[model samples]
Target: MMRQTRLNIRWRLTIWNALAFAFILVAFGIGVYQLLRQAHFDMLDKSLKNRLVTLEESLQEGSSVEDAIRDWVGKFGEHSDYFAFVCDGLQNTVGATATLNQVDINRLLPNLINDYGGTAHDSAFGRIRYASREVQSHGQPLRIYVLAELEHLDEELLLVRRTFLFAIPPALVLSAALSYLLAVRALSPVEKLRLKTDSISATDLHERIAIANPNDEIGHLTATINSLLARLDESFDEIKRFTADASHELRTPIAIIRSEAEMGLHNDADHSRTNKRLSSIVEECGRLTNLTSQLLALSRAESSINKSNMKPISIDRLLTEVVEALEPLA
Candidate 1:
């Protein structure tokens, strides 16, 4: 016995559709996140540059740069804002709004003068946002360094990342659901085909797959299958008719042989009568041989019809040739 294999088109389609949806959604999400991060960094860079310019202008004023810086620093601290520092070439802090402890000044002063000049430096200090600018005063060049706590912007960035991360699960779930529904909708025709096919059996070979539509690939497939089934049904009918006809044709010859043998056996040593019966048996055998040969030829013809390669041919020429070949047999 051969084992039957079960197929489920719905589950197959669902898996394929879900995978496609996930691939597209993940690619889109990565692109959007990268764009957002780039925009954030650009905005932060621009803001740092503007603050550095403001500090430089304030320092160039005729008033005491240290005093002016102290006032600015006091106001900034009152508002819980970022601190600024201005230094001369000697590396000594000339003007600083915030108190410069040894560690704060030491860690920032060298990097401000050497590592950065009129450029934004994000990695100068560990976890500190620092920007610097070079300014000329009284024919002397000075470096102004600005330091701001990155905690606020860092927090905002962290929040954005978390929000996107959290959204991914729901997005994926929604995409999967939509993909499954679409797959189901797309495969409904196939499901119908399955049901129709299941309803038919070998005993009902006369039944065929319905071609509900004729313009699509699925319709074409249904039509082809139906055509095959129709051919099978015709071949089976021809086989049944041939079997019946062959049995009828053979019965007469078999009966004649049996009757002739019985008569010859019952007759009393009549040579003439025995020879006549024997001749009749020989004739019946010849007839049986012819019938069997004809049956075999028909079977071969039917098999050839089923397996032959089809091509365009002139119908009139083909028919004329067939008739000429069959003239003797007819």
Candidate 2:
């Protein structure tokens, strides 16, 4: 039972520590993942905005939508991850609109919003983010799209996700193990208290605990226990002294009564009836004397007191006086 109690408390401490550590770790991982995602998307959006500005600049020079888009693609294609397309008001392809060779403009047209960059999903290209601008080309209204693939963004997110997935479990395991060790270390004092309490019994109240830190709660508890033991020890000593004194006083009286009763039986003037009564008195006195001795044995620890308050008395006279003061029971 003592072992079980210790284990239960230690296990609970370990569990709570591990849970707290896990919460902090998971929250931190989520925060880092979010920051990385936002940074990547912000970078993509900035590049898309820059590409749109270039396309708008080309169109402002009075070039047709197709020419502006073609020029913009030519300039950025060397180091760019963007594509350009020109479409008419009916969302139809304008001149030489093969700028996005793999991307169908119609697939992108339905998902576009006005003059702002946003994400759109497609079956072939997976996901697309684009910024659009309206331009007047030779008095014909046209729209230019600056788009980039979001597959790599997803890939980056997946990599981060994989990193957390791969790292968190082992981190949690290590955290739990460390938590268990710390719990054990911190609860060592408590374990010692348990062992001390288990070893104590009513006979041995002299044991006490000593801690290096006396200002802590455990120290206070140990002090309280020691105080209780002190009280019990004092009380037990008092009880023992009382028992020994009682037994000694009782034995003296019992021996006096038995000797007097036996002397009565030997008296020549005693009738048969008085002799029978004396025999009964002697038997009862013997029993009482044995009981008093047993009490003295049980109260083995005794202390001597100053007997200057007491005086010597004659035992035979005291016995005679006691007999004269009492009558036989019917």
Candidate 3:
């Protein structure tokens, strides 16, 4: 199933951390873009409104459209991102900044005071934010248009977006790597415990795992396992003691039975059926005596009580035998 094939804890942690970091990073990038875009547009709108207001006042104070355009153009200078133009009652362009073209004037000119006060797209400038106002110029109805290009704004935002795009993948990879390393470090104790547990067997129940700390969760779990092993050791010892005791008790009874059977066999030798029965009893007692002796030996082996008379093996010979035994499997 999918559960069995799923990623390990370390990989899962890395994935989760990467995902969380990606989300936060992307969210921060988007928020920064939104704030900068809004701020740029706000400043642009305020400038356009101020320019329109100043131009309206100039025209109202009996200033000719040409004089107003000249003054505004000089104030803006050569590197200006805005263009100002004026149209008379006939909708003919009477005055405009030096950079204004026929297409820019035609596509972007507002028809009424209510026409524009926000952003618009233009074929000449690609994108522009504009503000328009109707003003009295020498007692004739006049409309003035102010357009600021949105190209710079778009470029700035695009730069910000690109920076985030370039940074996200590397940041996610770094986060994943760090998370994986931390997971491995954190789970090392569990791995050690697993290795230690794997080495334990029925014959080696006395072996124990070392605990570094007794307060943490891993330490507590190891302590519980150690307690369980202790109980198991005690139970096995009890079983061995019972085996030895039963074997010792059975030895004398079986010997006595064999002697009685032999006597009966001799006394009943003239009767063939009775002699056969006594012979069978004698054979069974011999088997029982052998079984008890084997049981006693097993009990002693389990307790290691029969090894007192044995001498220590030579280290060189032991190593050679061990290597020979393992070479085939290897």
How do the residues 266-314 of candidate 3 rate in per-residue lDDT, one tens digit apiece? 6675577566546556655665776677666766876788743445769
TM-score of each: 0.76, 0.74, 0.68
Name the TM-score of candidate 1: 0.76
Order of models, best TM-score first: 1, 2, 3
Clashing residue pairs in candidate 2 (N, C-alpha, C atoms within 3 angstroms): none
Q: Which pairs of residues collide in candidate 1?
A: none
What TM-score does model 3 achieve against the real structure? 0.68
Better of 2 and 3 by TM-score: 2
Clashes of each: 0, 0, 0
Question: Model 1, 1-330: lDDT tens per residue?
Answer: 999975576666666767777777778877877787678667766766676776667657644667657656554453333667766777776666544555677676645544443322334344555677777765667777766666666677788778878987787787777867887888889888878877877679898776778999889988887897888888889999999999997876787788888888998499898998888778668868967977887788888843434469799997975464333233
Task: Compose the digit string of candidate 2's lDDT tens values, residues 1-330.
Answer: 565535476788788888888899899999999999899889888988898888878877898766776787687764335677777788777743354552466666777765676888767677888887788877778877877888878898999999999999898899888988988888888888878977888799877777657899888878888898888888788897786777676765565566657667677586775676666576557657756665555455333322223359899997975574344421
Measured with C-alpha atoms, the lDDT of residue 83 in candidate 2 is: 75
